[model samples]
Structure formats: structure tokens, C-alpha cells
Target: MGLFYSLRGFFRSPGAPPRDAGIQSGQPGGYSSESAAEVTFDSAMQISPVWAAVKLISETIGSMPFNIYEVGPEGRKIATAHPLHRVLTRKPNQYQTDVEFWESMALNLAISGNAYAIIQRLGNEIVGLLPVSSSQVETTLLNDGTVVHAYTTGANVKVYGPQSMWHVKLFGNGIVGLSPLSYARNSIGIAIAADNRVSRVYSNGAKPSGVLTIDKTLTEAQRAQVRASFAGLEAGNDDRLFVLEAGMQYQQISMTPQDIQLLDSRRFQIEDIGRFFGVPSILLNQTFGQSSLGSNVYEILAAFYKLNLRPYLEKFEASVPRWLMEADEAGRYECEFDFDAALLRADLQTRMQANREAINSGQLTPNEARIDEGRPALPGGDKLLIQGAMIPIENAGLKPVQEVPSGTQESEPR
Candidate 1:
């Protein structure tokens, strides 16, 4: 009876009519009349801001050191020198370098809300992660509530069970993720249009050739010859001069004021594109003042990490152990991106000051601080140090005051 019910549920049709498909080709959101045209990841890259923002984000995340570590019972972390670490830090596959694999996955996750990597195993041990293009992959729902991934490459279609694929999703239902490109399709389209217009003005010889007025009426042959000559001059014939025997006036037609205004509009459009991607305008090199964040580069970086990068890191942390670790090791093992290097990347003076404070506060040993700064540890550096003046609150003011020496005299008031 249970098997029959499960089979029926698997093959059951939707209770209601399907809504309009979304701007993205395979997304589930209902499309409305006001929906904009489709903007694929490739199409969106045409807009420079979109390209830059995506590159900035993906490359930044990819460049971070990713490691797999074991968590002990007392919350101590021990770095795992496993095969997965080698694959992630060196090369995931033959065709892609470490950075390339990570950047590609990050780009897919940012644009499509899902990043898929095919896990290759040797016997029961996992060996490699091969990237699968998100565009060519689809998720299918089965009757038993099992979801399968279908990856289409050319004429070949390969299906994968959930266990065989490393799937990272953001803002998704259980089956599939909702693409950011689909939601911001209209904004991306507008940015593309603005970019195209700017490119037309800057490239493609968009200048008006000016009006050539002849005082005397000419034959068809004469008119054709005149047009050809004008075309030749406009086609980068810088040394060519127009020889007009008849009465001809060459009135230059310059770009209109409105056409010139497009340069400014393009700049604004770049910011708009950044906004859709959650990138601050300052990061795009735009003229946004840093007054709000008080002009501190460190603060701005902290904000970027927190506001822009933290969520993505959190997602990876949650998913990596579940997907990459053996089930038996799940509770004790995990993966993390080591962000301490980035967070503490500062001038030497600042670093020393911070390190001194940490050591004095008994939070870090002198040797640990030396290790972080890439210096050799000294003898007796392993012990945690606290400032001599930093007594416990209960012992404050408990010591007896000493009397002044006879030879010492207090300075009289000036």
C-alpha cells in the first residue's frame, strides 16, 4: 500500500495550471507581462559593471585559502591534510587550475543561485571535483521526493543522483535555486542597452558624415561618384582631401547635446548594475564619497566582507561538510575558508600593535602571533602573556601604598 501511494505521488500532475516561465530559461518563477527579456550570464557580461562586479566577487572568494579541518570535542580545529584539500588548492581537474575552478563555480553561484560540481571517486574515496556548467544542468523531481540532476552535454544527457554531485544553492526551494539574473533581468537589460549606446558613440564609426550640398544638379553617375568619394574619406582615409570643382558645401554635423549626455548616463548605469549585484559604488571606482564609513579603508573592507562576502562563505561552510565529507565523519569533520589572513592584512605597524594587544590581553601566545606574522618562534614564546598592570578587578587597589624615599622631593606647584 505504501509503495502504491509513493508511486502515485511521484507521477502526479500539478494541481493547478503552470504559470508563465521566468525570464531565465529553466527557472520556476511565474513570468508576468511586465517581465523583461532574458539575460543569460553571457549576455549580462556585456555590461562592464556586471562583468567587473562578478569578477571582483568570484576572484576574491576564489583566492581565499580553503581548507578541510577536523573539529575536536573541545572546539579545537585541526587542519586536515586530505586529498580534497589537494584537489581544491592545486587543481580540481586537468583542464582547470585551482583558481579557475573556484572562480567558475562562484560565478555560477552568484548568477544562477546554484553551483554544481561532479564528484569523482576512486573506489569509496573521493578524488576530484569536476565543474558542470549550470546552464546545461537541470533538476528533476521524482515521485518518491528524490531529486535527480540531468546534465546535458551536446547530444549526451547524463543523470546524477544527489549523492554524486556537489550542489551549492542559495535562495532556493528544496529542488532548485532561484537565479539572481532572473530577478534582475530588467536592470541588466537596461545596463546592456546603455552599454550598447555608449559603444555606438565611442566605436563603430557612429559619426555623421555631414551634409554634402551641391549647388548644381548632377547626373546619377556623378551622384554615385560623390557618394563613393565621401564613403572613402569617412573610412579612415585620413590623408584624403575632397576636391570639389562644382559648387559644394561640406557642413559638419556634430553630435547633439543629448548624444554627449550619454557618457554621464553610462556612468550612472554602471552604478545601477553594481547595485543589483550588491557591490558598493566605491569598489567600482566611482566617485562615491567614503564619509558614511569615515574614510577608513580597513572599515570599508570589513563592511565588504560582512555585507558582500560573509553570506557566501556561510553557505559554503554549511554545504561542504555535508556534501564532501564521509557520512560517518560528518559530525566531527568540516570545511572552512581561512579568512584570518585577509581580515588581518594590514600595515606592519598596525599588525604589530594588534598582535601586542592580543598577547597582552592573554588571548594569544607570543609564538602564535609570531606564526601568524610568518616569523620564527623564540624560546619561551609559547606562554601566554598578560600585562603586569592588568590585575583582576577583585585585586585592584588591594596593595599597600609605599612611602616616598627621603632623598626624593615632590615638585612644588609652578
Candidate 2:
């Protein structure tokens, strides 16, 4: 079920003719035959780099605040106290907390290009949203142009209508979304290959193979005996040490230069995977001694939020109300992913400066600024405050009334 749509029809069913075992001829769409079986969301996760990148994006998004609001007629927005909010915060279902639910949704959307949740409602009110595993799901279209999703695992299959499921897609037509893992298969294959090679080296007692050479020729029986003797030394903890007869030599078979290059290729592959996921390499903790803006965590975080996270937030903000609320109610309600907390998380000095500017510019009341700083508001703080000396630039041309000389008596004309 984790299969890519490219392989959707290539799979076998009982009544269908046997097809090539998930292997397609030629490198169709940049994916080689060798990696067709390994490009699944689950398989991609097996590579450490892929997992790290996916986790970084998913967790960052999951930690963001999801808010529901009511937009009034005059275009004012207010936080809404809806049952869905309680359900999202307390338990989306029996298994997931708000964080866990959103994290899973993000992970699926990142890897498979789709996230699905089964909506459970009591009467007309939705009380829960249970996540369905993306790996176990398939989407199909009907003749009437309706889209249906079927979830199957083992012997069980469940089908859901559009209203019963909350589905979010990334970079796809109205019906189906394309998986990023499919496009990133080649880079992931390189990482997986590198990991496998290193694992094999360690599995063989961390010893490189070598060519055993002798100064003189030996009989077949003698050669067999020599091979057995070497096997005895190389089989166990003694692998680090080797004993040879006089005039016998063991020359280690060093990896060729081309083979050695694959080690460096692994590092580059991490960046490649990051690009496919739209996450900067620096966010993946990859600093290859090059200059990086990530040295300032706040700057990189801001870039990440704007470039990678905002578009996704917009998608959900639009989709949630459309699917979760009644049409009439949807007109009045809005969903938003709040970044205020992140904006307020700047260094103490920067946050203080920002607060000062906002307060002085009349953009925020004293109480509001203090609330953002997590401080108690003082009396009279609710009033908007601006700098006392701040005046209109046009007023600069007007001179204050010429004050009467302090020592002179006021004019009698008064």
C-alpha cells in the first residue's frame, strides 16, 4: 500500500495476469529499476538521512500552534471556543495527542504527498479525527468523478467517502497526490547503498579483504590447507591478527579511488534529499565547512518558516474549515497556524527591542506587549501608549507661540 502511483497499476491481483515484480524497464522518470522496490515511504525511512529530514520538517510543523477563529462581518478575527479545539488538544482519538496527530499528518504528507484522517462524529458534531496509515491506503476515481479512498492491510479493507475523511494533498490534481519519495529515490538509494556497504564492513569483523600471496607454488592439497588455516585466523575475534608462513605475504586490497568517492557522495546525497523535501541542508545539521546562514538559528528558522512551512499552513488553513465545518458555518469560521509564539521566541534583546518599537508606534497596547513577554500587566496598561515627544512631521514647521518674556509683564491687550 506504500506503493507509488507510478507503480499503482503494476501490482498484481488474483484475477490479473502476472506482471514484472515492481521493476520497470529503462529509467522512467529518473528512477532506476534497482530502486523501484526501495522507493516506498517505508523504505525511504530506512535511510538515516531521509528519516532525519522528514523528522525535522514534521516536528517543526507539529510544534506550531493551530488556531480556530471566527471572522466577523467587519473582518475582525477572534479565537473560537469550538468543540473541535478541545478534541484536537485533548485527543484527536484514542491514540494520538494533538502533537502526535499533527506530526503523523506532516510525516505522511512529506513522504507520501497525502495525509488522511477518519472523522468520527457524535450526532452532527465531529468529536475525533483518527489518522489512517498512508502506507495502507489507495485512492481511486469513480465514473461519476467522485474520489474514493480504500484502506487495506492484511485481510481487512475499509472504504471512506469524502465527507468521512479529512484528506490533504501536496502537489497533485484534485484526486491524487504524487509522492516525494518517488522523485528522491535515486539519492535515497545512494544513501542506502552507502549504509549497507558500511554495515557489511562491520559485519565482517571490520577487516578488509586481501590477496594472500606465496613466494612459491604449492600442491592442490597444500593450497587447500593454507586456505583453511587463513579461514581459522579470519573467522572470529582473531580477525585483527594474521599469521603467515615464511615467504608468504598478505597484501590488503585497498578500495579503488572510484569506490572511495562513494563515501563522499553520501554526504552530498543528504543535501539532495533535503532539497527534495524543501528543507535546507543546514536544517538537517549538515555543515560541510562552507559558510551557512544557519549559524544564526533564528535566521534559519525564519527562512524555514517562510519558505517551507507557510505554504503548508495555508493549505491546511483553507482545507480544514472546508472539510470539517458546515458550509454556512465555514463562512464565519477560519483556521490558522499561529506563528506568534515563534516570532516571540527571539533572543531577549531582540524581543525587547521589537516590543519597544511596537509600543512606541501605537501598534500594541502596553498590556498586550507585556502579555506577549509573559509579564503581568500594570494598571492603565490597556491604553495604547506612544512616545510623548513623537509629533507629526508637519507640525515641525509650526512654531510654538512666542512665550512672553519671563521677567516682562504680560501685554495689556489681553
Candidate 3:
């Protein structure tokens, strides 16, 4: 049976503040963190690595086009005429385009570990979707194992069941998904603290200060004069130079290994953020050894789709039937993202290489390859072709000799 969480006493109640369950963003003490700096969604995004990692993942998955297919006797075919076709491809809601809707949904999922959309209906048919912020929505678990969701923003309050809320959750128990930003507070907080400290140091004075030793003791007035000379050696005094008069010998203070490691730590933090967000270091522009070598870029990219993105695609696909389609219709229809149609193919050379591999391996017909390249099909191109030299290992070196064709000229014995 379909479940519904009735807002028992809220139908006509006067406006009231909703309950606060999750940690709040943008506030210092809201997000629990061991580090000094606050770690909230907004604050974490201020970190460059965090921003890049989130953008890379959400944009890649959200922008990929998806099609609904009808599975039947012949084969799966695009269900273009279905109502979902327009909703998914052209428009997801009245105000937002399909791309915008999915991208925001992906962003929500990346940070909060959950994405919610209210199913806008015209009678019984779903016509549009309205995205709700995961921060403003909270899920409650009843003793009987029934999951209830409450959406609260200011005076507006809404209570709905799973049927009305299209929820995509990250890794967690069935009731609530674990929020990446929430769990990453400590790490992100430390990174933010490091970044801020470095920036502050650079801003105030990053220049190395030197000790100016005078051979003889100076009067109080002489010491003041000397101190005034060195005052101009701070951060913003690039064009100014301190005069080393009165037998003052200058000794330079070079950066120690500990100071150098501080810079290295910042670079490592980029990779740290990428790892947590399921983005490779290379994608975030971090250069490392063999794994990130230039020649292996293609392999890394291919692995990104397979390792990082495939599971995310599956998550979206798995949720479609439960949230978008009727029980009976769900069995007959399937949705798949066009992972290769555009984005992953990337370049003509890569696309051509992939097509060649598919055709040569008999996985695709010549005509199908042509279609993928957006070219006209050639005559007789529909026939599949493969390397005729390939044969079963058991039959290797044991092929029967072919008899000469009739009327064929035999070579003179030589």
C-alpha cells in the first residue's frame, strides 16, 4: 500500500516557526567542527578545492541527457511521446529549464546528501517539479518503520509521504542519507583555517625579515632611528629598501622546511577534497605521479565515468520508477542517461576511436557508427563486420584445409 504522512494538526493552524533538526549553514557554532573556523555548506564552498570538486561532479552528472525507453519484444525504444519526455528533456518545472533543474538537484545531493522535488500534478498526471532545499526539509522515522518528511521554511510548512517527495539520498541508512558537508566539517574546517592563515600572513607581511646587528651599542635615540629604518620592510614595502648604515650587518632569515610544508599542505588539501567528493585529483588540476601522468589522462577520464559516475547514474535510475512512474508502467519503462552521446565522447578523435573499436569488435554496425557521428548511412553498411582472423582458441591451428574452387587456376608446381 502507498504510504502517506498526514499533517494531522497543521491544516489550519496559524503560522509558526518549524522545528530545527539538521545543523544550520552560514553560522559559526551551527556546524559541529573540531577546528577553529566554522565549517558550513557556504563556508566550505569558499574553499577553492571544495568548490571545484562539487562543480565538477554535479555539472557532469546533471547535464547528461536522459531518455525514457519502453522495453518490449523487439527492443528498447525511446518513449518520446510520453509525458515524461518533455519534463525530463525540455522542462522540469514552469520556471526552470531541464538543465537547471537537474543541476540544482545534483548540487543539493552533493552537499546535503539528499535532493527533494515536489511533484506538481495536473489532476492525476504529473506536469512539473518544484525543487525544495534539503536544508529546509527533515525526515522523521516512526516506530512502525514508516518514513515521514516535513518541509519547513519560515511560516510555510508541508508534510508529505515518499509518494509526493522525490528523494535521492547519498550513502546512509534507508531513512536519512549522510550529509557530506556535515561529516566533512572537521577536514573542511581545518582546510579553511589553513587557507585563511596563509592569506592573512601574505597580506600583512610575507617578506622575510632580516636581523640588522650593530657592532657597537647605540643610544636610545639612535636605536629609535634604526628601528624606524627597518619599519618599511613589511609586506607592502616592495619598492622601499632599508639602509644598513652605522656598521649594521644584515642576516637573511630563509624559510624553514616547516614553513615550506605549510604550502604543500594547501596543495594536498585539494586532493583531499577531491577524494571525499569522488573526483580525481587530475580533474581538480592536481598534478601527481604516474596516475596523473599526461599520457594516462584518457584512462583516468574513462575511469572517472566508470568508477565515480556510474554509481551516481544508477542511483538516479533506481529512483525514477518509484517516484516518476506508476507501478504497472514502471515495469515496462526504463530510463538511461546518455553517457556517450555527447559529454564523455569529448572530442572527434575520441569519438571516432570509440566507434572504430565498437565496429571492429562487432558490437555496432557500420551504419550505426555513422549515425553516431551524425553522418548519412552508406549502402550495405547495416551488415556487421568483425576481424575474420579471430577464432575459438580450441580451433586454433586445426582449421580444415579448403578445397580449391572449381575452374580456379592452380599455380604451376614451383
Task: Give the best candidate by lDDT.
Answer: 3
Q: Local distance difference test, per candidate?
A: 0.73, 0.73, 0.75
Cα lDDT tens digits for candidate 3, 229-259: 6755644535565677768787757563266
lDDT of 1 by residue, 1-414 (tens): 334434544566744222222211235334333433347778888777888888888998788878777778777465546677778778788789888888888888888888899998888777788988888887777666677788999999998987798888876555566677776777777667666665654453554446788998899998998987776444342445668657777776766427568667767767777776777777777765453544777887778888887888888888877878777877777777776585639889988999999988888888999999889999978876668875443355587577988999988999
Against the true structure, what is each candidate's TM-score? 0.76, 0.81, 0.73
lDDT of 2 at 365: 82
If both were scored by lDDT, which would come out higher, candidate 1 or candidate 3?
3
Residue 243, candidate 3: Cα error in Å is 5.9
lDDT of 3 at 397: 62
lDDT of 1 at 304: 81
Poorly placed runs, candidate 1 (over 4 Å): 1-40, 79-98, 202-206, 209-219, 229-260, 288-294, 326-328, 389-414
Task: Quote the positional error of residue 214 for candidate 1 in Å.
Answer: 6.0
C-alpha lDDT (0 to 100) for residue 31 of candidate 3: 31
Considering summed lDDT, which 10 consecutive residues are worst modelled in model 1? 16-25
